[model samples]
Target: MTQKRISKELQECLTTPPAGIKVNLVDEGNIHNWNIVMDGPADSPYVGGKFQLLLVLPTEYPFKPPKINFKTRIYHPNVTFDEHGSMCIGILKSDSWKPSSRIPNVLTAIQQLLLEPVPDDAVEQGAAQKFKEDRKAFDKEARDMTKKYAK
Candidate 1:
């Protein structure tokens, strides 16, 4: 049941991806793991960067929200600056997630996050502080990191 649903969603995503986003399976035989290439939003500091992300759907997908992690590092208040590259987003939260939510919506939300980060609800305190205290520095650092790691 889960595989069928995932395959359907995957096909839809591949055929019609969200703006600045491309999707593919991590492996041909596996339908649960996905590889995503998201183009940085033009208005944001991350522009010109190609970010890679991993999205994993559980066996109980739809009932459970999919998990996404940045394979390419990003400097953002909502994303941890570590090897894990975990992100903090409202839609992906289990309590907020609904089975009716689609993958395209999730990908769009991620793009929105890059365009406008929620510093108050940040996971990375340092980035949040810089974002809140010094906007210029934050943008510069984010752009620098985007060049260094998001290339």
Candidate 2:
């Protein structure tokens, strides 16, 4: 059931992706794991940067939310270091996730997060502090890191 839904979603995303985003399966056999490439929103601080994300679906999806993490290193308040890449988005959490939410929505939310970070609930403490204190420096570092890894 989970596989079927994921397969359909994957097909749809591949056929018609939203602007500035692309999705592909990480492995041929694993429909549960996906590789996402998102272009930074236009005119934003992150503009012209490409970002990579990993999406892993649970065995019981819909009923359970998929896990999303950054595969490309990004300096962001909501993403942690150590390459663990845990995201700090409300929709990814159990408390906020809804059964009706789909992969497209998740991807959209992640892109939105890049444009507007939620510093109060941070997974990367240093990035969050920098973002709060020095917006310009944070933007520069984020843009540099995005160019380095997302290219």
Candidate 3:
């Protein structure tokens, strides 16, 4: 049941992909893992950067939320600035996730996170504090990180 649902969502995302985002299964026979590439949105520090991500669906997907992690480094309040780049997206949380949610919506929510980081619910406390207290410095650091890692 999980495989069938994942396949359906994968096909839907492929057929009607979100702008600046592309995704593909890691293996043709396996529907549990996906590779994603996202272009950073403009008017933000990450503009001009292309970020890679991994989306792993558990065997009980639809019943459990998918795990998304940045394969590439990024500097944002909601995304940890490290190799793991674990993100803090509200929609992906077990508390907020719904079985009705689809891959496209998840990707869209990620994009929105890039455009607007939620400092109040940050994964990286320092980054969140900087983002909330010093917008200019935060943008500069994020842009620098983008150039170093995402470019």
Best by TM-score: 1
User: How accurate locally, in lDDT, is each candidate?
Assistant: 0.95, 0.86, 0.92
Worst 10 contiguous positions by lDDT, candidate 3: 23-32
User: 1-151, model 1: which lDDT tens digit per residue?
Assistant: 8888899999999998988899999999999999999999998999999999999998999899999999999999999998889999999999999999999999999999999999999999999999999999999999999999988
Best by lDDT: 1
**Per-candidate TM-score against the hidden true structure:** 0.98, 0.93, 0.95
Instruction: Encode model 2's per-residue lDDT on 28-90: one tens digit a residue.
Output: 898999999989887556788887888999999978999998877778898886577888888
> Cα lDDT for residue 27, model 3?
84
- Which sections of candidate 3 miss by over 4 Å? none
Look at candidate 2 and give me any clashing residue pairs. Answer: none
Each model's backbone clash number: 0, 0, 0
User: How do the residues 15-55 of candidate 3 rate in per-residue lDDT, one tens digit apiece?
Assistant: 88899999998887888899999999998899999999999
Q: Tell me how many residue pairs clash in candidate 3.
A: 0
**What does candidate 3 score on TM?**
0.95
Error of 1 at 80 (Å): 0.4
TM-score of 2: 0.93
Sorted on lDDT, highest at the top, how do the candidates line up? 1, 3, 2
Off by over 4 Å in 1: none
